[model samples]
Target: MENLAKKVRSKKLSTRVDLTAMVSVSFLLIIFFMVTIELAKPKAMVLDSPDHGCCDCPSYPDYGENRSITVMLDENDKLIYYMGLLESPIIAPKEIKYGKDGIRRELLKRKNSLLKYSSKSLKPESIIVIIKPSKKSNYGNLVDILDEMKIAEIETYAVVPEFTPEETKLLAAN
Candidate 1:
């Protein structure tokens, strides 16, 4: 019998790994998160005031004293408010606290009264607020009062920095 020779064979294994799919998946995840995220934006408040002696300034109609409310901001977070003219005010100037129960309540009450009165007549009317911040009053106080005006929804308002002599005395006394 002839001797049979068996041939020995060696097997080769792959040394490389497929990383293209993994890289593609990682990039897809990164892109998805970037597209879905939202960036922060700056917030701003709208201020409406009359232009100072501008030749092309639009003329605004004069508002009545009956529909006016003057608010004075003092130091130590004290607030004073009055209605109509200071000389002959429909509502006398008085110190009031700040917040929903304080200035806001007073504003709403006066606004409703004026609305009722105007409703009887044929002309449309709204409350006009005059914000006067005293020298001793801080900027935060001014911001708070402005916020109150917004809360009370008094559309027509002005920020008058200068104070009258009587107003100065009134604030000094308070």
Candidate 2:
């Protein structure tokens, strides 16, 4: 009878598992994941966009059309750019490809030209890029153009949504 009692006690002892180590490990794992997730938050790019809603917003007309260029984005990655005002352009609206040899080259060329002109004329003048994205154009194209602007170190640029009748017709015809 005593042997039987001892055997039953042994079985009860075996059944009782020590869960203290498992609990501590689980809590440590939970804490580790929490800390990792908190540290892994995504970083964002800072863009200083103009406040269009303000009535007293500054205009760039004083900068002169000579210092300005307009880039129109269309479907299928088509980029049309014109120097100066559309009414009196230094360079007429023409399709240009993207990348180092395309828009970047043009931007650099124009920037260098403006620098030379400014040095000779003794005036404050810099390249102003006006970006106009058509409805058919994708967000990726706009982002790409913005990236190009940053790559070219452009200081003044705007993303204007409105398009003139002539501009719309020009885009449609192209």
Candidate 3:
């Protein structure tokens, strides 16, 4: 019995736990978390403003009854003017050139047309110009158009984003 007890006590039980599988699982979990996480992007905001007393207000109308003249700047910085509002047929300027003088000439012609259509006592202030520049349009061309609008004495102008309703909603939500 003493010999048997000695043998039993001397024998060691092997119980080694392998950590390789655990380490691999941990690595896979880390990789999955890194892959699934979404990075945030910066966005701009649009706000509704009262018609009379807000600075930096969006060019959209409150009652949807205001007159708006839309001018489009294409990807090539080409100026395309539309009289009236959105969904109106795009009207081409008499001449197509990418310069300040050309824009001024076109604006003058448009002003004259407005005068011809309206009563002689009406001022150009009744018209609201809306500039719709393409995403890839040249900044310089936009500046030129702005200058022309100023020269034409158009004070109530708006810069509208060239986006669809869904895109606008997405942007607004963000």
Rank order (by TM-score, best first): 2, 1, 3
Q: Candidate order by lDDT, highest to lowest?
A: 2, 1, 3
lDDT of 3 by residue, 17-95 (tens): 9999999999999988886674334443443334675567555343222345566676665666545433443452222
Best candidate per lDDT, number?
Answer: 2
For model 3, the stretches where C-alpha displacement exceeds 4 angstroms are 1-67, 85-95, 120-125, 164-174
Query: lDDT (0-100) at residue 106 of candidate 3?
Result: 62
User: Which sections of candidate 2 miss by over 4 Å?
Assistant: 1-17, 20-45, 52-61, 121-123
Top of the candidates by TM-score: 2
TM-scores, in order shown?
0.70, 0.76, 0.46
**lDDT score, candidate 1:** 0.87
Per-residue lDDT over 21-97 for candidate 1, one digit per residue giving the tens place of the 0 to 100 score: 99999999998788667333455677777878776975547588998999999889989999999899999999999
Whichever of 1 and 3 has more lDDT, that candidate is 1
- Lowest lDDT block of 10, candidate 1: 1-10
Query: What C-alpha lDDT, on a 0 to 100 scale, does residue 77 get in candidate 3?
Result: 59
